[model samples]
Target: MIKYIGSKRALLPWITGTIQSIHHQVPIRTVVDLFSGSARVGHALKAKGFYVISNDLMTYAYILAQALVEADARTYSQERVQPILDRLQSLPPRQGWFTQDYCEKARYFQPKNGARIEAIREGLETEAGGDPLLRAILLTSLMLAADRVDSTTGIQMAYLKRWAPRAHNDLHLDYPPLLNGPGQALQGDALEVAAHLEADLFYLDPPYNQHSYLGNYHVWETLVRWDKPQTYGVANKRKDVQERKSPFNSKREAREAMQTLLGRIQAQHLVVSFNNEGFFAAEEIEEMLRHWGFVRRLTRPHARYVGARIGIYNPRGEKVGRVSHTENHEYLFVATHSRRVYNALSDHTEALQLSLF
Candidate 1:
């Protein structure tokens, strides 16, 4: 998977353990990930023998879920997919719109690698044909390849003024570590999905702050959509970034949206992850969830993302502001109607090995 802002990679053990503990008390066969950003949590749950239904509003996120969560590795094994990858890799790099926009205009990637990205992406449209899963796998490969060579602090909001050492390396695609299972991926609003999708457990990881994922990852959006959309600003963000706003991104509307979404979700159990920097406080979220059942909260302190640690930088790449704080609190809330489920989580809390505060 590509580098993501709230990937939940470090916290996977705790997330999975909580679900497994709940499963120990009551069977949880199916889990619905309402915001499967990188599909890391969904993929982990699937690997633990849970049928996962992963949904996200972003097309690239949907693709990640398709490749990692929905597509069964037994059906689309590395052996079966490598031949197509080989063909894509052998294609001669061609300079095109991707080169002009991302390379020449914004400098997200080097011109050389950007040309390869264009060629491979264009070739994927033909090679993957009509198979959506195959298309997702190819896109995943291309996206990961691009990520390795991107000259940024793990975001597309801006590129490094000077090329990072990794930017000089040749772009290479490797097969993603897909698991053997059956799952589903949907692209839509979370509230809408929660209204209809019923499952044993529902995981909510909504946008916590004003920073939009689409704005941070506009390049990936364009790469997967292949829309060649009109862009603006020094970052060359898709114009839609301004137009496509989520209620969760609004301080005024976030609370109401969360309340409505919490009311609509139809699940036996719910696990939610929220940042301390988010619009709502942890106590406020607990209060909202208590309407459903008993809620238990766990807190983990971790370092902030690299971009925040690097402080504020101008377009010239000079640091212009002091770093406020380099750490963050990620709060996980588990809510269920059953008292036994809550006890099971509380009992297993010690075993989670996450230094919860």
Candidate 2:
């Protein structure tokens, strides 16, 4: 999987455990991942035998969800993946749009790797035989392969001026771990999707602050969209980056947005993931969730994302300063209409020595 900011990879154990605890009280047959960035949680849920509906507003995220959560294990066999890899490796080093901007100008990837990225992306669509799922798997492979050798400090907002060591490696593709189950991938406004979609549980993990995922991972978006969009600034970000904003990124609007989303979602149980650095305070989140159902909060001390630990760097790739905080408080709020489910989650938290309030 690609390295993503605010990814729940580190917190998966606790999250899955919490969900299992709730399942003990009330079976969660279907789950809707309202903001399935990277589809990490949704993939886990699918693996646990739940019919997962993963939704995200970003094209790249939708591709990820389709490849990992929606595609079944039997979809990608060696016969399917080997030929694509061979084709990618055999592609001539052509200076395409990806190379001109991201490689030669922005320096996000080495020229050699960028050329391969361009070649693979151009060839993937045709090779997939008009199957969206197959295209997703191929695109995901390219994205992950490019990310592994990217020179940035784990984000595309900016790139390291000097190539990182990993940038020297050749790009390669691997089969993404696809779960065996029925699942769906959606790309649109989560708020709008919530109104019509019904599920046994809804997992909400909206953007925490002003940092938008579109801005953070623009390269992937452009690659997946294959729009050859006009770009600007030192980062060579897509021109429409500014237009792709989420209300959850605004301090003034985040609370209201969350409240509106919670009110609209048709689900029996809600599991929300937010951190201490979010726009809303923990108490504010608890208060908002309480209106819909009985809410129980769980907190765990977590190491911040890898990018956070690498100190700060300007867009020009100059070292700026150090980050003060080395750790973050991750909050998992479980809101359920059932008292039994709430009590089970409460007991589960107590057993794990996690703080509950």
Stretches off by above 4 angstroms in model 2 are 315-318, 353-357
Q: Total backbone clashes of model 2?
A: 0
Q: TM-score, each model?
A: 0.98, 0.96
Candidate 1 residue-wise lDDT, 46-111, digit = tens: 999999999999999999999999999998899999899989998999999999999999998999
Model 1: which residue pairs collide?
A: none
Assess each prediction's global lDDT (C-alpha) against the native.
Answer: 0.91, 0.86
Residue by residue across 47-122, what tens digits does model 2's lDDT show?
A: 8888999999999999999988888766676576768767766777677888999998789999998888888888
**Residue 100, model 1, lDDT:** 97
* lDDT accuracy of residue 95 in candidate 1: 99
The predictions' CA RMSDs to the true structure, in order, are 1.2, 2.1
lDDT for 346 (candidate 1): 76
At residue 208, candidate 1 shows an lDDT of: 91
Best by lDDT: 1
